[model samples]
Each structure stands twice: as C-alpha cells, then as structure tokens.
Target: MPEPDPNVRLSNAEREALIARLQTATEEGRLDLHEFAERSREVYEARTYADVERLLTDLPAEDRALAVPRAPAASGDMVLEPSYTHLKRQGAWIVPGLIRVNPKYSRVTLDFRTAEFTTREVEIAVNLEYAGLKVILPKGAHAIDDGVILEGGQVINRAFTPGGGQRIRLTGRVLYSRLKVRYERRFLWWRW
Candidate 1:
C-alpha cells in the first residue's frame, strides 16, 4: 500500500479511533496515563495525517492502524448528557467550536488544560436541570456569560477574564441547578 498523505485533514471518526487506540495502549500497559493524555491531546489537535502519525510512532503496529485517513467535517459540535452519574472531560481531549451540555440530577465538568481548540472562539450552550455544571479554563483565557434563564438556580462565574488568548462564550438555562466557571492557575509542578 502507498504511504498516507501527511497533509490530509482528519475526520472525526479517524480522530476518535486514534483516541480509542491510545486508550487501549494505556489499558495494555504500553502507555501510562500521563503519556496517554499527552498523546491523546496531540491526536485531537492534529490537522493532518502526518501530525497524527507522529503521535503513534512509539506505539505498536496494531495501535497505529487505527489512525486511518478520512475527510474532515465542515464544522464540529460536541454534546454531553449525564443522567445520574458524574461526567468529567479533562486531559488532552478535543474541544470543538460548539458544546452542548444537558445534565439531569448529575454533574458535568469540563477541563480545558490540555484541550485542543480548533477555533479562536468557543460557544458552550447548557441546559441543566437539578444538576451541577463546572467549567475549568486555563489562565489568560477569556469567557463571557451572555445570560441564563433561571428558575430557582444560580450561575457563578469565576473565569470571566477579558484579556487575550482564546474566548469562550456561555449561554443557556438552568433550572434548580448550579453552574460554576473557574480558572485553573498554573502551579510550579504543573507543566502545560
């Protein structure tokens, strides 16, 4: 077979497959959590096949096969809904342009420390009912709370810093729930 084109853009399915492969590697003791997280972030942020292939250079051939080539989508949106259990998305996950979170009687946390943002601006639309939603952003990131229609609930924003870097706009409604947005401070031992 011919070598895959390095400059070819990746599709969502291809990226997800790579992520699953990495997770498998971690489960098989081939990679640790830190290494898997780092590689996973790289996979999501990768634009071309070459960018993704480099991440699997040290992995086994079976794992590398998951990084197949596919067409890229015009736009990407991620949706999350937790019914009873808590859901947390952290590490090196991909952060699309639009994110919709709807949780009922559960908790959802989104950490954007090692996340890859394809666009300069991100929009988060939340429809929470009797649940808790927390968003953690990196320092220097800007966020705007457009507005929220509440029915016996509160929206506490501690990450709204209008400066530079990337921008995140939050909008939606909360009914008998809590939405907290905070920033992650850089520590001495933490390396981004």
Candidate 2:
C-alpha cells in the first residue's frame, strides 16, 4: 500500500485514532510512560499527517490495529435507575466520551482496564441520590475530580493525578451517596 500523504491535514477523528494507538502502545509496554506522554502531547498538537506519523515511527506497526474504526454506541450515556441492583461496565467495551451515572438507591461500578477509549480524554458525570458509585481505572490513567459536588455524602478519590496517562474527568453531584475512585495496576507482575 502506498503511504498516505504526510502533509495532509488530520481530522479530529483521525487525531483521536492516533492517540488511541499511542495509548495501546503504552499499555503493551512498547513505550514507556514518559514517551507516551510526550507523544500524546504531540498527537494533540499535530496538524498534519507527518506530524502525527513522526510520533509513531518508532512504534510497531501492529499498534495500528488499535486505530480501527468502530460503530458508535446507541447512547454514550450510562444511566442507573432507582433499584438495589449493581451495574458494572468492563471488558472490551468502548469508552464513550461522556458517561452519565445517575442512580438512585443503586450501585454503579465502572472499570476501565480493558475498555477501549476513542479519545485521549473522557468525562464521566455522576449524579447519585442515596446510591453508591465506584470507578476503577488502570494505574496510568489520570483523574480529575474538581467538578464533583457532594451533599450529605463522601467522595474518596485515590486516583487523582495531575499528569498521568489517559485523562478522565469526573464531574457531578452526589446527594446522600458515596463516590469512590481507585486505580489498580494493569499487570500485577509488572511495575513501571
């Protein structure tokens, strides 16, 4: 296959796809955290194909599979209603750009270990009344919790890092409920 025009301007979706590939490379140990961070910043700032391509020149070609396009979900929002049931989102599901968790008298758990993110940044909005929400993220995932509003509830965050890997922004209100954010290493045997 002929190589794409390096000078061609990249679209938003194309930039996001490249970022996803970089994230996968980081997770696969093909690139270190520092390299991933540097490349990610370059990806976002890249205006042409060559700018983005230069960042991935050292990465293996297999990482291109991570950029394959997928069908969009019916709804990007995840809602939990008033019930005693527990809602969990894990595995190879696509991580939406915006996730809404509004549960009354229920528990919601969102695990982003193996989830595929189409964007470099993900925003999760939580609004719980008399419910509980626990978000589990991979170790390198960076979290921001400044937008959370707690009313008669407590939020325990163990995953708030300023400049980590993929960015996750948590925002919403919790009334008479509990919200916890924690992180776990992707591989138990490997430590970076």
Candidate 3:
C-alpha cells in the first residue's frame, strides 16, 4: 500500500503500533516512564497521521518508521467499527464522500471542525447498537437527517440547516443507541 496523505486519520491499530514502539523505546532506556506517559496520552489524543508522526519526530528514524501512515481502504468508503474503545476522527484528516459507522457498545465521535472534505455532500450511514455516535460538523456546514430508523434510539440535530458550505445526509438504523449531530462550541460559550 502507498503511504497515506499526512492528513489522513489514524486508525486504532495504527495508534497502538505507535504506542508499541514507544514501549520498546522505554524498555531500551531511550525514554523514561514520565516521557512515556506523556507521549502515550498524546498518542491517544492524536487525530491525523501528521499528529502521530510528530510524536515520534524526536525518536530515531527506525522508531519513526513504525508511525508510517497507511493509505485509505481501496473501496474508497470509510468504515468505522469500534467495539470497545472510543473512536475519534478529528483534526486535518480528509473525510471521504461516504462513511459507514457500525459501532457495538462503543462511543464514536467524528469531529469535522478542522477536517478536509473530499466531497461537498457527504453521506453518513450509521448502524449502531448499544453505542453512541456524535458528529461535530464544521461551521457553515448543513446536516440533514434524511432517513434513520430508530429502535428505542434518539437522533439529536443541533446544527441542521437547509443549505450551507457542505451538506451531510444521515441514514441507517440505530438500535438502543444515540446519534447526535452538533457544531463545536466556540470559546466554550456558543455553539456555532
């Protein structure tokens, strides 16, 4: 697979691989426990491939190689299935035209506040079970709750407009879960 664009989002496996390298560095006496703990938090909080790479910039090239980003799936569509861990997609990562989120008993967040969109109109098909999905759209972006069958589930749209910079159509089923679409709270005061 070719190297992914630096703006691509890092997967859970990729984050784990980077952390594994950090663990190795700690064992090799290259990093102290304090540094390891700090870096580990940054790794988990990282969103884009560039963020992951930045964490290993001070390390040796051999260790940095473990942070190499992988290209998107050949299918073009992005599929997110987080079982237990929290899945967050934020920062400068590129958003595909189509995204299918199928989470089981996990909390998933797709924050597009500073993300790059490949398409003007994006479709998010969320099929969630016993999990919650929150989508934070960028400013001027509009979201439309097209058709999402709910079985004891709730869909909250706090940032849905008819037309705007980008259009997001939500579709699929939610069983005993919650789907929330809202804009980021600006300055911790207003939701814009």
Candidate 4:
C-alpha cells in the first residue's frame, strides 16, 4: 500500500472541515478524544467515510501530530476537551498533576469549609447536610456516576494531579450521606 505524503500538513481548509465535524459531534457529547483522533488521522488516507478508520490505522506515528487542541483560538460556546499532554508556549512548558480529596471515595463534596489555593495545598470544604452530591472532577472527568457528588464548574485547575493534587473536607453528616452513594471512576491505579 502507498504511504501518505509525510510533508503535507493539513490545510486550514481541511483542518476547518475536520473541526466542524468534530464540533458537531462534541456538542452532542459524541466525539470523544479517541474517536476524534482516529477519524482525524484517517482524513489523510480516507477514500470514503467508511475507509477513514483504516487510513488512521495505517498511518505512521509521525502522522499523529495532526491532533492539536483547538481551544483558546476556538470561539463561541465551544468548550474543548482538556488536554492531557504537557503544553509549551512562548518558551514555557506546563505539565498537569492529579487531584487530591478526603475519604478517597469515588464521589466527593464541594462545599468547602474554606476553599483556598496554595502551592503546597488546596482545599474545598462543603456542608454535607444540604449537598445532594459533590465531586472534584477535572475536565473530562471520565467518572460516570449518575449521582457522583460534585459541583458544576466549567473550568478546573488542569495543572494539578487528581489523586494527590488537592484536598477537600466534610463534616460527619457528609460521611453518612455519602455512605450509600456509589461512584464508578476508573483510573491508572485500577489497572494495577
């Protein structure tokens, strides 16, 4: 089989086309990163919609650089999925760590007793009594618990690592209320 042109960068027009397709699916909560990457890589080799995935699979590793995060430059009502890779711009590089929480349950509370940010520690205290739920979810949390306790913050601290990143606290009532609540989040530790 013929390899694709390595020198060819995706044209702005082509990138726009792909972005449009991805945006449509993302709005519907359908274009996940894995799917987006696969379809995008296929665009170079695709002869037909049905053949797109095959092109994606056949490409060399170098072809994968086409998947760039389209945020900041992306305009209007579109919240792009958070980037998991480290980013560098203007000679500065940023790496993301994890989240830290109390009790270490799948679900958590948000009403912080006192929410503060420090280079060493961060805290979000919540009144467990009125809280229906609370979860310290980062963007694209991937945790799929219907009643996972959390707050709805469009933006979160992406630079922090989840497991040991931040910390939260709740009163005794919060503990009891969370007793029956179940959370189903899978992370790297789960594999080990």
Q: Each model's C-alpha lDDT? A: 0.80, 0.75, 0.81, 0.34
The digit string of per-residue lDDT tens for model 2 on 1-192 reads 456677878765566567667767876789976897788778768888777766776777767622345343424554445356666765556677888888878899888887778778888888889999888887688788899998999989888875557898989899999998888644768832
Model 1 Cα displacement at 98 (Å)? 0.4
* Each prediction's TM-score versus the true structure: 0.63, 0.57, 0.64, 0.22
- The runs of at least 3 residues in candidate 1 whose Cα sits more than 4 Å from the true structure, single-residue gaps closed, are 1-74, 185-192
Could you arrange the candidates by TM-score from highest to lowest? 3, 1, 2, 4
Under the 3 Å rule for N, CA and C atoms, how many clashes does model 4 have?
21
Clashing pairs in 1: none
**Cα distance off (Å), candidate 2, residue 165:** 1.5
lDDT of 1: 0.80
RMSD to truth, every model: 7.6, 13.8, 7.8, 14.3
In candidate 1, how many Å is residue 107 off?
0.6
lDDT of 1 at 15: 79
In terms of lDDT, model 3 sits at 0.81
What's the true lDDT of residue 117 in model 4? 27
Query: What digit string (tens of lDDT, one per residue) describes model 4 on residues 34-128?
Result: 77666655664444334432433433443432343332232222112222321111111111122222332223333221222232322223223
